[model samples]
Target: MKIVADLRDRFGVEPILRVLGVAPSTFYDWLAREAEPGERELLDRGLLTEIVDVHDRSGATYGSPRVHATLRRRGIRVGRKRIERLMRAHGLQGAFLRRGWRGGSTKQNPKATPAPDLVDRDFTAPGPNRLWVADATRIVCGDGVLWMAAVRDVFSNRIVGWKTSDRCNTDLVLGAW
Candidate 1:
């Protein structure tokens, strides 16, 4: 239909419509249709603008579920599927945080001697402060990456000390102790 309309002046509407397998009367009816936007389409345009605004304000980290929730909070009544369709239509996407491998290798080092196991898989201790377990992890935050060290008393199964820093080093472990 669109091709026939665009090429009507150049090659004539009859030939174009015949080539495109569209009848002349059908094309004429479509061309003579109302030019005004439908009510539902107008409402969708407004809703999409609001959705884009919310998505932008969230740093593009909000998916349809979150976007729908935000819209509901603002007193906008809409379904999750509708929001998803609008987002997909406009090529709007959300940022996803992925968890990568951060554990030690399974294979042991040939040159390094293995340290003696103090706990020997025994996590319980007689009392607090008797046996403490420590570990460190890296957290990705909005500002930057942060290093965290935590010390837990095995007996109480509670964290006794903790420390955080921008850099992961021996001092972080020492501070947690």
Candidate 2:
């Protein structure tokens, strides 16, 4: 909004962005659509309606890439980046990102309890039962998540104790016990 107001007021983008703590490169990206045909560049009411059409036909899951592809297939020839900028200006966006595996933290906390770097980092133990280890992991099914608790006998490398439950309450661990 600030950038748009700045561009509208002075016919320049860089200075306003600088005054408002935005980078010049971002303003330049917004200006990339300046090369489009005048009518298409404006993304007026009719074009905006069409953009919404394209966006919705995709179940609202299409970002500019898929939206542009859909438009191109329908005989519209707009750059993907241009579509992106127009979408931003109009406050239209695709669905939020789909959940995925949470990235593991990488910061080595000097104060964090340090695992003895087991297997000497080998990650491979020669014999089972030699290294009894236990762990609890979670799995998500239709309705809710289930916690799986297990103890592996390092000597025979066999699961000696195992339990699964929808809850990880003490009872669940006791059940495994």
Candidate 3:
């Protein structure tokens, strides 16, 4: 009512307030208690510091979800949406990833000569030296990814001989054998 009287005496503000579904009195009341420029900047700076701190402490690994958790852990009350906004503003992000089972048995090639299935998936032997199964798996080492060919005794399921190389050449399997 006071705002309507004040606005009526000054510039026209009733139509705009009516369009926004808020009373002119309520809008003027909010304007009176609005945050100044300096206060808003200070709040933004503090929030940015918290965001950066959480990101660095996470070894740059935390996404918005984890960052939200970290903020709550430190007693900083924040919502996930707010954390996401802050992270976006700072250009901080987590690693990209694909979801699914990673590696599996390769489809048997019709053209290429197949290594005989000596064990026929039995994966069992009566004695230690009776059967040996071989397969190649990749491992990351100091210098680069190393392709390792290993032979395991079916009886004990223990890897007996293994060799690693930068390339998946026959030498790796032969050397392991």
lDDT of each: 0.88, 0.71, 0.79
Model 3 weakest 10-residue run by lDDT: 100-109
Candidate 3: deviation at residue 86, Å?
1.7
Per-residue error for 133 in candidate 2, Å, reads: 7.3
The local distance difference test score of model 2 is: 0.71
| Per-model tally of clashing residue pairs | 0, 8, 0
**Candidate 1, after superposition: displacement of residue 6 in Å?**
21
- Residues 23-46 of candidate 1: C-alpha lDDT, one tens digit per residue: 899988777653556788788999
User: What TM-score would you give candidate 1 relative to the actual structure?
Assistant: 0.55
- Cα lDDT tens digits, model 3, 42-133, are 77679879988988876787899988888898898878987798789889997555687455435557899976876677877888899988
Ordered from best to worst TM-score, the candidate numbers read: 1, 3, 2
TM-score of 3: 0.53
- For candidate 2, lDDT tens digit of each residue in 35-68? 4546645655566778899887766667788888
TM-score of each: 0.55, 0.34, 0.53
lDDT of 1 at 99: 83
Range of the 10 consecutive residues with the lowest summed lDDT in candidate 1: 97-106
